[model samples]
Target: MDPVTCAGLRFAYGASPVVCEVDLTVRESEMFALLGTNGAGKTTVMELVLGHRRPSGGTVRLFGRDPFRDRRRLASEVGVVLQDSGCALDLTVAETIRLWLRLYRRGEVARAAAGLLADVDLEHRAALRVRQLSGGERRRLDLAVALCGRPRLLLLDEPTSGLDPQARERTWDLLRDRRREGTTIVFTTHYLEEAEQTADRIAIMDRGRVALTGPVDLAASFRRIIEERIG
Candidate 1:
């Protein structure tokens, strides 16, 4: 079964519906990108998949099990990095990673903490407090924390948003390595080029519905489709 599967998924906040009849499937080791404009319900989909919000209609499954009902067990297999996550400002980068490791407890977190920081180019800031880091540096720190458990499914929201060119490229390379290691990744990004360069399959959402879904080879066409939808 696909790690993530949603069929006819629907949701609403009171009188207004946000997601309407969305169907998507993310295969194992696939780098799936969800692209959309502001208020297009992309973030809502992420919340649903992570079981942070319940679906009002249809179904969402992770590894063939209902995500909401099986969330406890699924936690071990899923890693998520949201756009803005709260971390103790006083905690150093290394301290934060070690603390996250305590949650999963799969193995030696101390040994892996250094590597995680290095992977995101935060090794130089390992001893620096979280509050002392720049916006781009904090984003990288969030990534490092999400990767602590080597989860099978990774969900990232605007992961490289504030990063510089070199940092962005490094983040891209890290994703490539994760994909090679059989990690299924799902991400939402406003940057079309990031999606075009990394995603195997891309889904573009507009006004709570999927406007375009296709292979990256056809990304040029998808770009036009997104523009038309926005216009």
Candidate 2:
């Protein structure tokens, strides 16, 4: 089964609609990217897929099950790193990871914590309080914590938004490694270059619906759209 599926999905806040009749499917082990300008409803779609928001209409499925209805059963299989993950600012980086491990799994908590820290290149910052970390560092921490349970599907929203080029590449490499290990990833980004380089498939959203969806080779079309939007 595909890791993600959305059919006729709809959402809104109050009377205004944000997403309308969107249909999408993400294949297993593929790196998929959702691209759009701010307020284009990409974030809404992310929330729907992660079961954080109920769809106003239609269905969202992860592995053939409604994500919201079967969240607990699906929790271990999915991980998410949002732009703001609501992480505790008071805890040390190491403490935060340990805490997540305590909440999510049973054994090898320490070992897993170590591995996650290494994966995000934050081993040296382990003792720093989360509040002390920079935005990029905190982003890395978010990724580390999201990976605590070793999920098969990873979801990210504007993950590289504020990262420097070096940090951005590192994040990409980490994701590439995970993809090599057969993990499916779905992410949203404004950085067209990054998406063009990393994504196997791309979906461009406009006015709350998918305007275009295709393989990465659609770069020429992508450039034209971006130019049109700019001009």
Number of clashes in every candidate structure? 0, 0
What does candidate 2's lDDT look like per residue over 198-218, in tens digits? Answer: 999988888788888888888
- Model 2 poorest ten-residue lDDT run: 222-231
Model 1 has an lDDT value of 0.89
Q: What is the TM-score of each candidate against the true structure?
A: 0.96, 0.96
Per-residue error for 129 in candidate 1, Å, reads 1.5
- Candidate 1 structure quality by residue, lDDT tens digits, 1-231: 799999999999997999999999999999999998889999999999989889999999999988888889998899889877678899998899999988779477777887888889888998999999999999999888888877999999888889999999999899999999999999998878788899999998889998888897786675676667754
How far is 121's C-alpha from truth in model 2 (Å)? 0.9
**Please, what is the whole-model Cα lDDT of each candidate in the order they appear?**
0.89, 0.89
The CA lDDT at 63 in model 1 is: 95
